[model samples]
Target: MFAPFRPIIKDPALRLAAVLLVLFGAHAATMAPYVSALAIRVFGLSDSAYSAVLLVASVLSVSASVGLGILADQRANRRAIALGTSAMLIAGSGLVLAGDNAVVFVIANALILPLSASIFGQLFALSRLAASTHPERDRPAILSTLRALFALPWLMVLPIWAVVFDHGAPLTAIYPVTLTLGILIVALTLAFWPRDGATRWPDPKSGLTFRQSLREMANLPILSRVVALGTINGAVMLYLVVMGLVFAATPGRGASDTALYAGLLAGLEVPFMLALPVLVGRVSRTSLIWVGAALYALHLGLLPLLAPTPFVWLLTIPGAAGGAVVLTQPMAYLQDLLSNRPGAGASLMALQKLAGDAFSAAVFAIGTALAGYELAAAAGALLGVIGAGALWAMDRRAARS
Candidate 1:
């Protein structure tokens, strides 16, 4: 379970990469679970507007990710890109805090924050490239471990947020916390992140024009699989979108309950996340992802059904087990799709996010329009299962051919 931590501790590059992800996760713990609430309840956006904000954010985030991925490949300068995206994150946080109004919230969420989201992919790309010289068999473990490191901060940070919110801190306190984290990310990058190819992680420039690079990503095998994983991810996205709302709306539950629920779910997820590498070669990645999708779907579908009672807590079991596989496995699977170009491959995380989030936003909008948050969650669960099956079928066909 802890095997992945060995090299990360011994090697400074791996250590720095690992630290950066933990920081990013800390920032995510604060921001992600609260976005829908902040937009609708605090910032005074309506359901329709909130849905639009999320859809636009997904498109912008993935566009920036794809562009940077291509640029990183050409320039071989993950350091510079990382620094720029970190700055964007800080700026986005500052924008929200400064204006403290719906208009600025819209700009930050739909434009700046989404653009900064590419930083997640950049961190993974840098880590993957840094480990380019490791044995082929060890690569997935390294990436999976980096992902686990990313989830680690959630265990600690979200629980603290839960405590703070319970103690009566304003919910918007997350912005300031996020701002501080972004600054720390910048400091870490400036102080420790290596220059381009400094560690001899060979640059993989395909010498393709911009259009040519995108065309490569447009290939059927890669796109189909990406969409499938994204579909699996959409359920998670929907859970984030509606969890806070459902909890706060429930008579017995309120804001603090929302935070604690998210925090506890995250806490359960970390241990399972650390154990992912052990399953790497023993099972096919898609098979694990498909099974994970089903398990997570069970949790998603049940979350609202049981929200008013203590049994809701049990959802964390499947949530953690499945969350561990889907969240960690996709990183390795997507990266290998374009293994030669580390930048582009890592950016697939962002693209998979784009597809998932686009679906999530649509379901949230349509479901809420037709019914309510419960319907949205159900729609997301169904999509996830179908997506997982589609991915399994696609891979089986490829194998037989």
Candidate 2:
């Protein structure tokens, strides 16, 4: 496990990148799990209203991601961008915490959160650029290690959230804490970010125009295949959007129980993700993805049957394993497909976020309206199975080509 990261730590720049990812990951973990609950409890949003908010956020997030990716590709100062975005994130969190009505919360979610979320694309672009300087075989491992490190804060933060919720603290507690972390992230990034020239992939004498890059990406079969699979993966994520309400409605559970379950599920993913680099060299990436998809199907399929009991939540362990694969493999695969274009990871991620979030919103609205969270989980399971088959077919085609 430590073997893959050894080479990464030997270089000062890679080491700093890894640290920055941890901080960023912590910030992300704090808010993502509770956003749905916050919307319902604090802002009195219904399922459809929350979905609409997400739809708006998704559109804005896509735009920010594309704009940031182009800027990064053009060799703009990523550190400055990241710092400014972090500040925006803090301000967004403040709005969520203090807002007494849905309108303010919607603005924060739709505008500031999407703007802040673009930081992940920027971070991915930066990390891939740094890794480009290293040995080819080591790149996936290095990035996987960074991803695993990201799980660390989730491991710590979620359980603490569980405890806080149990002790009568409001969910709004997460906002202030996340805001503080966001400020720390800004400071750390500004202080330790590699010099602009030091971390960049050598820029081509002439860069592709935004239109050309979009055309190039659209024409790539590998990217299309990955995006198709990623959309199916997004179905699985619908479970999370409504998970808090699902758990609360269960016979013996409430907000604290929901938090604990989320925390445990998140904790389970850390080891799975940490083990991914080791598995990559031994297991084929496509095969790994197929296995993950199958596990996700099994996990989601069981949700309706088992949700009455707390043990049902354990299904997330398999869900986490599946997520560990879906999360790391596609990014690595995308990076491979666009090796010459340093910003392609960002661009592809932006597209994936747009596609995935849109699909998730649809699932949430339709499934909840048709039945409830149980129906949504079942639909997600069916989609995961479809994704697994699609991946198998795509892999075979790639082998033939």
Candidate 3:
């Protein structure tokens, strides 16, 4: 297990990037739940508040990510990360400040929460930067390892947040702690990974203008597919996430069993993602994607079989399989596609993020409005099948050519 950990970089900036990722990942897990806990326990909002929280989070994230992506194109990656981390600090603090005023909290969420994307989106920019600077073979491994770091949050912060919120802790109580943590992490990021000129990529001479980047990415075949896949997957994922309440409420399931089901799905993402580098390196992108699409279809197919009993635990295998496919290979495909055109790569990434946000929101809104939980599941099941068919069609087209 430890043998895979070899020294790839002795430089301070790269090391700092890794550390910043850990902190950001932790912040990501805690941020939503913190505000949510407050809304439920302190503000006395209804369960609809949870969906509202996700919608608000999605909006702020998409907006912030786009702005910061453009800023990243124009400014330093470290600077964006710093500003973003600073925003997370402020956002977390605002949750505490908003207290019981649900309306004020929602506004704060819209404005302040999106700034956290500065940190989240910066990681992608930084990875591209690192690949540009360092050796190529190491890039996938480096990215995969960083992604595995994301699982740490569920382990460290999520369980803790669940405990606090489970007992009905105030938003005031939770937000302050998360805010302090954000600030400390930001400080560490600055101290260890100081921003400098070289990190500021855009200049008059790079020839990578925003419009040119977007046009170039628009024409890239693989990036287009990746973005499309993300759009579909994101919508389905959001539908599932929102519909989880229904799954939990499915007749005989206890709250503990539901929590266990969710945890299994989260925990399964790491090892599969960790193995993606090796898998993508060995398999053709088309082949890997087709396999993934098939697995995703199977996973969603199995979901309906899950009941309130211990048998539901078996559903995690398909769930984890689907996550592995989404988290691992499409990224490597996008990175490979972007190698000759990093600017276009950045734009494609932004597009991917935006599409995911928009499509997920649309699905969630429509799914909820149509009916309650079971109907939503039926819709999600259709999406899974349809998405898989789309991928299969794309694969067949590629094969013919």
Candidate 4:
């Protein structure tokens, strides 16, 4: 069980990536569950406006991710990229903290924060490159272990946020908390991030011109797989949004309940995440994702119907098992699709995020306009299955070709 982390434990570069990922996850754990609430309930953006902002943010995130990824390959300078994005995170939080309007919230979320989100893909990109030094067979396990470590902070941070919110911290308090995490991220990068030309880290330079690189990613095989996986993974995005909104809108439930619910589900997922490395060769990745999408769809489709009752707590079982697989597998899979282009491979994650966010935004808008949150969640569930099936078909077709 613990064997997966041996590589991370032994390698300083890998160790640095794991530590930084935890801190980054900490900020996300604190901020994400509440970001939707802040946009709509606190800042008074309409549902349509909020979805539009999320759509715009996805654009920024993908642009930063892909541009920096190719540039990272060109210069092999992940440390430089990490430091810059970390500062952007701080600036984003400060934007919201200093201003008190919906427009400011839009700028923070849509521009600064989304650009900063590129750090996430870059972090994995760094680790993937570093892990290349270890035995080839150990690579998947090493990545999975780091991913679990990323989720580990949520176990601790979300509960803390619950306590803080319970004790009457303002909803906007997440900005200052994120501000602190951002500063620590920058400090850590300066203190421990590997040098660009370090012997320990082998940068995979794509060598393609910028236009050529972009054209490669735009290829049908790569883009279609990303889109299919992104659509399937969109279920999680929808779940996150509805979890906060629907759970909060329930008659007796509120912020504390939302926090605890998200915390417990995320908590349950940690073990499964840790356990996934064990299944590395025993189960096919595609098979696992197929099952995961179905289970996740079950979790999402039931969420709105059951959120009002104690029965809702039972969701942790399926949500954790399914969420664990869906959340981590897609990343490793995407990275593999562009195996040699570690930086561009990492950008695939950002692209998946962009596609998922766009799908969720559209689903959320249409579902809510047509009916309500339940309909939105159901739409997410249905699409997850469809996307998963599409991916299976596409991959099988590609394999044959």
Candidate 5:
């Protein structure tokens, strides 16, 4: 069952992609979970402040990531990955040094988040590069592995922080280590990632005179729908994540409970990602998506009854299964589109990121303003319904066309 990963690494291009993915995961863990966890625990920030960080980071990161994507379109993957990773190393180092200054810390974190969006750079660049060297079905398998690799860092590193660092000491002390890791990642990416190659995809002219690639991507009909679906799903996903924490951290329940529930949801996702392709082969993508959507709806509806108990934890399983469906199938569909038009893949992927980021920020902002966790869950449920409707429409349209 798990043996395919062995062959995945033997293909040099895919292996390179997977390695870059792992490094990206390491970089992302620092900016995302590590930093946000620090802000919440050490700074004694309210849920609103933490939500704002995610929202602000999403906007800036998406904007920066799209710009980097255009640079990728015009240059070699190695140059793009090198430049982005270098930015992360600098930002990570800055975070390490700027420890006590709150303002500086936030600024550094914001900068660090966007730099980590370079992971998106690596994902898009390598996905395109891998497609050039391998068959189309390998794209989903590669993407699933790419996503699954992220779980290892979170599972391994995050719990360590939980165990060792009580308030935010671990985040502060570990900054230097993260910085060192950042430098190593940059060097490895620069050294081992594939460089200039035969025209696997058409290259646009260099020295872009300043036009938004996202606008161009949004203009494409298929890509536009994909971005729309992606945005809605992303927003709902963020709302679910944020509310779950809030519910777990309520007066009766503390941060430990929050952490436990969050960890459970996360743990389930990794294996789900690893197993996704096999499941995809056995079931239609449309069926998987609708089932996932329905499960999310059920999960959200149950939030009013949710409490900090092991029994409540079972609710997360269906939602987690739904999340796996949401996360994997869309990319597979998008990759198919990209295979038909390679030159557009990177930009389209970037647009999907931008749309998701923008909507996620909006959801976080709105949900944070609302006082009740139930309200947030209700909002998420609505978005899930909309996502399911869109998928249903698309599935019907595809059948007819």
Candidate 6:
């Protein structure tokens, strides 16, 4: 399991890239468990309002990510882009900290969250560049190992966050920590990001329009299938939104419980991620996706029945297994499809986000209104089943072709 990781880390530049990715993951863990709670408790927004904010943020973030991705592909200085974007993200957080009212808070989040969200795409692009340079290393394994590293910070931080939240600490406490991590990420990128010669750029004489780019991507069967599966998987976001709301509304549970559940799920994912080097050779990527999708369906289906109790959260262990495959495989698959066109990776990322965010917003609005969180989760599970079937079909199609 560790064999794949050893070779990649032996190279200094690759090692720093991996460390930066871990810091990025840590930053995400610190915020994810509490963003909704912060909006509600600190900014005094309702659940629906917070969801709306997220929806908007997702849209804006996709745009920023795609734009930045194009710039990254055409230029070799990914470190500079990462550094600048990370600073903008920190600024956004600072604005939120200073906001005195809901309007100010919303504006601050709108500005920062989208930019911050795009950071993942940037990191993915960087990872692809790193892998491309080291042809001897297993690309999928390297990406998977990076993803496994991501789980560590979540595993560590979530429990600490639980402690902080349980002790009646202010939700705002998370911001400063995120700010510090952002600073560190910038520092790492500046210090160790590889600087190859300037990357190839599209001809200005006949530049690729966004429309042309979409058409090109749409023509690829595998790419289209991956995007479709990812869109359907967006239902998972609905489940997440509902879970956060459920935790907030539960009689005895609060931030600490939410953090614990998320931490447990993330912890469970670590082993699976670490095992990816072995698993990648044994299982087809599409098959792994199929198994993952099935697990997602099971996890969501069980949530309504088991939530608000410790037993329900255990489902996250399996859920994490599913998540590990879903999250890591799609990315690796996308990277494979767009290996020669790194900018396209950004487009694919943006497209998936657009689909997921749109579907999630619709599901949250319709499902929550028709019944409640449980009903919404069930609907999400249904989507997971559909997504799973789609992956199976894609596998069959690929095998036949």
Q: lDDT tens string, model 2, 152-212?
A: 6777777787888889998778788878877787777788876665544564422677787
Cα lDDT of candidate 2 equals 0.75
lDDT of 5 at 38: 62
Worst 10 residues of 1 by lDDT: 197-206
How far off is residue 303 in model 4, in Å?
A: 0.7
Clashing pairs in 4: none
* Superposition-based RMSD of candidate 2 using all C-alpha atoms, in angstroms: 2.1
The regions of model 2 sitting more than 4 angstroms off are 200-206, 220-223
Q: What digit string (tens of lDDT, one per residue) describes model 6 on residues 2-31?
A: 776785678665687678778888887888
Candidate 5 ranges with C-alpha deviation above 4 Å: 27-31, 34-37, 44-53, 166-174, 198-216, 231-248, 251-259, 296-305, 340-344, 398-401
Locate the minimum summed-lDDT window of 10 residues in model 6.
198-207
Off by over 4 Å in 6: 135-137, 196-211, 220-223, 398-401
lDDT of each model, Cα atoms only?
Answer: 0.86, 0.75, 0.57, 0.87, 0.60, 0.73
Rank the candidate models, highest TM-score first. 1, 4, 2, 6, 5, 3
Error of 6 at 187 (Å): 1.8
Best by lDDT: 4
RMSD of each: 1.2, 2.1, 4.0, 1.2, 3.8, 3.0
Q: Which residue pairs in model 6 clash with each other?
A: none
TM-score of each: 0.98, 0.93, 0.80, 0.97, 0.81, 0.91
User: Where's the lowest-lDDT run of ten residues in candidate 4?
Assistant: 198-207
Worst 10 residues of 5 by lDDT: 201-210
* lDDT (Cα, tens digit) per residue for candidate 4, span 290-329: 8889988998999999988899889878988988899899
